[model samples]
Target: MTDEAELLQRLWNREKNSIDEAIQIYTPYLSTVLYYMAGNSLPKEDIEEIVADVFIVLWKNAGRIDSVRFTIFL
Candidate 1:
C-alpha cells in the first residue's frame, strides 16, 4: 500500500501521531471540499473555520470512522 494509506491505517488503530499526520495530509483537501460545499459564498476566514470544524469532527469520531480510507469516506 501507499505510505499515506499505511499512515491512515495507523491512525485508525489509534496511534497518537496519526492524528497529526492526518491533519497535515488532509488540510488542503478539506479546505477545497469546504470551499466547494460553501459555493464560495463565505469569506476565507469562515471557510477555514469550517474546514477546522470538519477536522474536529474527524478527530472526535476517529474510533468509529474507518480512517484507512477516510478521505474517500469524508
Candidate 2:
C-alpha cells in the first residue's frame, strides 16, 4: 500500500496517477459501503456510478483537502 500521506500530497499536487492509486486503494471498500447503504434500492451500475462520482469529487477538491487531518472516507 502507498503511504497515505504521500498519496494525499500527490493528490493535492493534482497528480493524475494518484487518482488511480486512490481508486485502487479505496474502491472495494467504497463499493461495499455503497451496496449496504443502497440496500437493494440501487442497481449495481448505480452503486458503481456513485463510487466513481466520489473520486471525481475528490479530485475536484484535492487542493482543498488537508493531508495532516485527511479523513474523507478512511
Number of the top-ranking candidate, with TM-score as the measure: 2
Number of the top lDDT candidate: 2
Q: After best superposition, candidate 2 residue 72: deviation in angstroms?
A: 12
lDDT of each: 0.76, 0.91
Least well predicted 10-residue stretch by lDDT in candidate 2: 65-74
Per-residue lDDT of candidate 2, residues 3-72 (tens digit) = 8878999999999999999999999999999998889999999999999999999999999988766655
TM for candidate 2 is: 0.88
Candidate 1 local lDDT, 3-28, one digit each (tens): 76677677667788888888888889
Clashing pairs in 2: none
